[model samples]
Target: MTSVDITEARKTDAPATPVIEAKDLTRHFKVGRGFSRQMLHAVDDVNFSIGHQEIVALAGESGSGKSTIARLLAGVYKPTGGEIFYQGRAMSTFKSRKDQLAYRGDVPMVFQDPFSSLNPAFRVSHGILRSLKLHRPEFSRPQREEEAARVIETVGLTPAGDIMHRYPYELSGGQRQRIGFAQALAHKPKLILADEPVSMLDVSIRIGLLNLMAELRRSEGVSFLYITHDIASARYVADRLMIMYAGHIVESGPAESVLANPKHPYTDLLLGAVPDPRAPLAEGIEGDTGEPPKVIDPTPGCRFRWRCPLAIDRCHVETPLPRRLGENHEAACHVAEPDPGFRE
Candidate 1:
């Protein structure tokens, strides 16, 4: 008998509160000497929301500022403009360390480099135990050990006994990565900021991590902001997708829809470049293919016009804001249109 995929069926009701949200979130940095100083736009005027038990992938090239957004949400860097709200409450209200602890406990981050993220000196159990000690003070010594073992197993590191005693240097790349997930699991976070968690692993290993994320979301009711450059992996696991470029979110919507009917010229180009295993490889992508400029005190215009084929005079003078294309789908483009039409 054929089994039904229940993932789509479970989306009938909306969560009571948005797990986390960004309202025009912006972060910038000053670079160079005093006379030649300029503000580097790391992340600018970004907005999105993650609901309970959902996976949202922020896809972009290396310097596209997707990681900056992750850091902003994780509290590593504060937003220069706009605000972050968690469960309908503005983060600004939580000023003190004590006040922020609860929010921090509810959200954990898994870094990109797994081996570097964990300490080489300590056994694998050290971080998980520390996380539990800080976030779950209620658990006693025995309970903490039990909880750590459980989380380690939850990430598919079997026997927990065999895994817990080893140091970071003892494990393989994939095992080290699973330990990263286990560390976050110890917090029992509502949302996880996974900053390219699988990018550093081998191709076969990536599928395991991706499936682990889906399992965590399904089994624990956790949400995630999966940041990656590979749209294929994003498509494999994400329910929603946001495309970032030059510190701006050029397009966003449900993942499958955005991939199927890309509304922005940049989005279309990104999809075109993704390799199709069944089909033969193609020549270079047709557009300019130039690197996006370093956004230092950028002017009001579409940043992608330098490479976008459909760019017009209007794109040079005015910045495009995200326009709705379909249900929960939008793109920031001056020329592209919805289904049944494409024009200026």
Candidate 2:
């Protein structure tokens, strides 16, 4: 198991219990039947953690398996390799339906599309009420209504009474997304797995959602595993940043440290891919247009060699192990030089 070397202490100097921890966690899909059965590597040996009240951004392009990791942590998809520890408890020990439900309640998922996540036929209150019934069974229907209203207001939607009566269609994209969060809050979760929650919203509206996440961490002490391809938004909300490529966590560190000095070629590539509003307009976006590799029965080497500028011969034959770049900074690259005074 690859240790999450970059993990931070949630309280004192000592390491606090991570809300979610993955130890060489992996997941693969069966693509074909019997004779032609092929494994499509969705998430491969992913190791990371979300400290108490910490926001860890899992940034990657499509097919990078960011969403799969979210589902794995949420107990929706069973892992094919390794184990997941929630607040230091091994998920493998959870064998019964009651245990599974408890885990789901503790870690609720907020998906990308707000409209699709909620039922159009039902009013907005349906999901929150149902979540309360399933998870917080102690709450009566009246108490659920009051708690639901509080959560709606918590997400910055005022007059919860008015919003609760409306259907998913009546709300704006941003409002619908906040409603998704409200439903998750009904579970009284310790952690939230938000998968591209703002990518579909307008640029101005995106910032508001990002700010809401930051506030959630500050006010509620809730941790978040924010998965998205947008590096800029990731930097804004995440305390720690992890870059994924071809189903592997290629880099991880403090958000500022990783963004300013990306150790992996893939991390650098992702940052370079972000737009600079200050720069003049261009006919076409510059940089390598290479797509991330499709890993189906993948070879035993770096999956990013096809597009990496710093790929050496070592990257072709042997898979590169993550080497320390600095304190709380590591990058999986064979030829990447240490920044200044790194030991390994």
List the RMSD of every prediction in angstroms: 2.6, 4.7
Which regions of candidate 2 deviate over 4 angstroms? 1-15, 278-292
- Please give, for residues 261-302, the per-residue lDDT of candidate 1 as tens digits: 889888888888888786666566778576575589988899
List per-prediction Cα lDDT, in the order shown.
Answer: 0.88, 0.86
What's the number of clashes in each of the models? 0, 0
The lowest-lDDT stretch of 10 consecutive residues in candidate 1 is: 1-10
- Each candidate structure's TM-score, on Cα atoms with residue i matched to residue i, is 0.95, 0.93
Model 1 scores a TM of 0.95
TM-score of 2: 0.93
RMSD of 1: 2.6
Q: Residue 8 in model 1: shift from native, Å?
A: 5.2
